[model samples]
Target: MAERPRTLYDKIWDDHLVHEQEDGACLIYIDRHLVHEVTSPQAFEGLRVSGRKVRSPERTLAVVDHNVPTTDRSKPIEDPESKAQVEQLAINAAEFGVEYYNEHDARQGVVHIVGPEQGFTLPGSTIVCGDSHTSTHGAFGALAHGIGTSEVEHVLATQTLIQKKAANMLVRVDGRLAEGATAKDIILAIIGEIGTAGGTGHVIEYAGEAIRDLSIEGRMTVCNMSIEGGARAGLVAPDEKTYAYLRGRPKAPQGEMFDAACRYWDSLRSDEGAHYDRIITLDAASLPPTLTWGTSPEDVAPITGAVPTPDSVANPAKRAAIARALDYMGLKGGEKLTDIAIDRVFIGSCTNGRIEDLRAAAAMIAGKKVSERVNAMVVPGSGLVKAQAEAEGLDKIFLAAGFEWREPGCSMCLAMNPDRLAPGERCASTSNRNFEGRQGYKGRTHLVSPAMAAAAAIAGHFVDVRSWR
Candidate 1:
């Protein structure tokens, strides 16, 4: 009898397995450990208490992002708590001998953005971080996920983590995407189809022609939001696009080593007839630029659609959830999204703050000015991204269009620093989450594509970018 074929997740998991314990947990080697200011303080403290040094400091990389201010970064961080967190991360990294990127470093940015840009995240590697968006690295065919402070300590102390194998899930998107549709829309549509908890207990492998056609940056955008759908991690099988993006990256292998690495990465895909615990397919051509009308990412609809009525839902629990979300968002049932006005617009985050995203928004709003009623801002994901955007005059485009072009940081994405929405303010945001008070206390968030957010900034209301185009 022949053995069954294995999935990409299974292959990667097996390759990294250090030891399988009787409790069904395995010790897996970590190839990369990305750290951010907000979550590593406790783990560093743990190492201090136990009198243990980092087992492999070379494998760990730290950056100050979450707690850094996007405004006047040269000035002292105004928020005392945030300043303390950033300072602590620097102290910890120095004491641990781990490479640290401070706010002043040109490479410094969001941990997820900096990792890929610097080639620290590689294909067929096992990566872990204390941040939930660590799944963003899986776009390069790596197995990565967010862990707690305890797990962070374990990885730091031993360069390994104990974990149970996650069930496999395949999310295949077929056909070509529509003109105005983007990777953001595709993922939003999937979340809408499956709901917020759809991928719980699973690692999603995105496959099919549509996914294969997306640019490496676009693929990252899709994988970055997998956590929003409750997936432990998300992955994409790497190909030429992935190799092209990694080829000259700062940490990528050179010459013969690069060729050898590619050969191995090429083989890191699901075998024919591999079994998945679940499979879902979506038609890409039918998907429109989508937006989240309620508090959850799963509460999505086409840009032209209206807010859903709670009474329309059949599930009692879900109906109540919709009701609560509607009340919190200050939305009325059957309200057309286009009729809703926005007080502000935010275009940045790990999900869509890459150079490609900046270019898209810049092209959309080049000649048009932001609505007089709207306060719009653009924050790059990293210092590298910021420099590249300026080189292309994207910052000038944004500023000319009345959009404030700010420094790089995870600005207004989770409101960790001074950038945040006021209470009762509604925004058209290009970030991932839209949970209640995510942008600020009582701030309502409408998740959108970069182009859509740009259009909203100009129109002061939600409008279909396809029509604008």
Candidate 2:
């Protein structure tokens, strides 16, 4: 008989599966179902059309972050498209009996942030969301991933998904990251080297030295971008760092149950001499603080690096893509990233709007003022994150530095929130995604780490922030 396999993804996927399909797919039970405004409308409509109730209402959690206004929530949305989306989500949740964190609720924010903060994202379970960033919850040791609309319907009807096993890929980073580098930089460099789709059809198991030293928020950021690399999911092996973060979380077990949970989490690591379908090793010493130069996160370079010229590229396809990015961004090839000025700097999103991220931004800009030319905002990711930052005086620091510190919501990341850039406004932002017109029509976005964003606000360009430290 073959020895049993115990990969982390396998362990969780096998444990929660209620049945196996004829096509080798597993009907895996969903432990947490996070829903936001954009994708839930048709889902709820589907439920109504078929007279199907939510399979497990308690497991299905809803929040209105994407389409709600960030600062002004006094009345209904003025934008016709935005107004209809929010109203539909409310109606859907009410009819289905699923818990809805409305715009006025304290729990309202990005689905990923709300899910973890509410203590619903426990370890040793499966979580699915209609949003791709659902991999953020994998930092808690849960096997989480995004689902399509069809899978969303499946969860509503049966609270399960028919999923095939993803090949396991181990990414081992051996060495502590130097000061000024973050998990963001590490993942950015990895994607830069591996290309965007390097992890297709695989579950990335982040391991080795550098990743172990990352904070939980940092790990969440790293895993949050898993989909950017075309990976099904990304995870860190559970450890002291993971436990310390989850210990006081509302949903984590307490006392003996907690102790037992930790023991099981410890056992989640790859066994001695375990094999992976693929292995990619990273040297932490070689990395530098970086930013994306093109639409894709994979199109990145060092903070001070220059844009690549099309003629400098040998491949015509590559040349065209780079050329298009430069045109849309109003940038030129071989120009220094520092020379690129911006009209705004935004610090908030599911990617970098947590308490720790706020502190990091505050640390960078404390006793300094934002550039007069730069309009900046700091929107928290959750009500809990907002309250915690306020208690710590982080909000005071942000406002003192000329940042408009607003309430929690998705904000400018996905433009599902009211906060968005105007046409032709270039921005240095901590949110992910720099696709053409992502923030607004013809609005250009340059993605960076939170600390880098604060530094850019102070300097009015993509300046290296390590000097401040």
Candidate 3:
């Protein structure tokens, strides 16, 4: 008999597994629990009603992001409901004695962005948040996912979650990405190929040359969108690049501890010949700058492609979905994507609001002015990212090009605050989703890369950046 080979997910799961139950479920310890305003209020209320204290308050971190206005943070929040939610989170954090980052805190930002920036997200850790995009932390080889409010309360009281293991999925992207293609393009292409439900009930491990070659920020962008592809979570194996990014971070381990942690992280990869329930391979070089033409993220095509005709699809369900999406997006079959004009351009979100993303957009629109008819804005992912961008003069480049440089806080990504699309308005956005009414009621969205969005802002239409350049 021989020991069975294991995947990166298996290794991390085993390390954190506290107990196995007869019902085929296991109790896994959570190393980090990141909370935000939108999801934590109810959970805290549950704790108050039950007379329970957080089991490991020190392990949990709280921030106000969702529903917080991205503009003029210094003033009172305008929306009453939004203000209440933000205020309640601050009160709850104070009551629980948990670490909190409010709008005024220098460390304040989206939980996903703040976690990695603060080094609270480390390799081989089990992280949970009330956010679906908590999978973003998986970029460091961690096992992370979103949980419901009840599950949030459970984790808060017990510091562990009971769950069944997800099936293993390997997504390999070999070959170098094309010059104009980015990690956003690569993930969008993967979703487009597999459809939104392709990785359902699975934990996806993104590997191969293309993934390995991406910068840590790029890897984060890919893993951040795994949920959109219907994966339980997504991860990249920790390596030198992961270590370099973690080194010298505020909460990261110190010298000798970091070295030891690296040793463990080195063993976090899948063993050679390990079995996966399913596998997908992509040729990275063949991918173009992808954009969603319909409602779903999978309803995407290259910038040079056109809207797909539902009539051309053979499957009734898929055809119906395509038709419905096309109706919602106000698109007709066979219309060239480049010919579709946009009313606005938004280049910020958890998906693409980091400094690298800002730089990428700035480089594309450096000397080009935005179309007068198009309202374009650039929002950074976090206050830190904002300060960094300003230091590098990226803000000036964007302002000079007619793009409004605004504050950070998931702006226009969900339209929770004032940043939203007017009814019937169409936008080229860097956000992950393109669901109907995602940006606003009856608003149409076309998801694209930061550079593609910037290019669209300038051209006032969807043009292939490869050609625009």
Error of 2 at 255 (Å): 3.7
Models 1 onward score TM values of 0.99, 0.96, 0.99
CA lDDT of each candidate?
0.94, 0.85, 0.92
Candidate 2 lDDT, 1-469, residue by residue in tens: 9667577877887788788878878778888898888887878788888989998998888898887777767866888998898888888888888889888897788888888887788777799999899988888778999998878988988888888888988888889887788878888887887788998999988888888888888888888888888889988877897787777676677778888988888777666666689899999987888898888888889986898888988999999999999898888889998888889998988888888888888989989999999999998998888889999999899899899988778878876656788988999888878888788888988888889999999988888776664
At residue 38, give the lDDT of candidate 3.
Answer: 85
Residues 1-469 of candidate 3: C-alpha lDDT, one tens digit per residue: 9979999999999999999989879999999999998888999999999999999998999998878887787789999998999999999999999999999887787788899999999999999999899989999999999998889999999999999999999999999999899999999999998888998999999999999999988999999999999999999999999999999898899999999999988999999999999999999989999999998899888988889999988999999998998888888889999999999999988899999999999989988999988999998898999999999999999999999998878879997888999988999999999888899999999999999999999999998989777
Global fold similarity of model 3 (TM-score): 0.99
Question: Model 1 over residues 173-289: C-alpha lDDT tens digits?
Answer: 999999999999999999999888999999999999999999988999999999999999999998999999999898889888999999999999899999999999999999999
In Å, residue 82's CA in model 3 sits off its true spot by 0.6
Candidate with the larger TM-score of 2 and 3: 3
After superposition on all CA atoms, what RMSD does each candidate show versus the true structure? 0.9, 1.6, 0.9
For model 1, the superposed segments whose C-alpha errors exceed 4 Å read 1-3
Ranking by lDDT: 1, 3, 2
How good is model 1 by TM-score?
0.99
- Candidate 2, after superposition: displacement of residue 264 in Å? 2.5
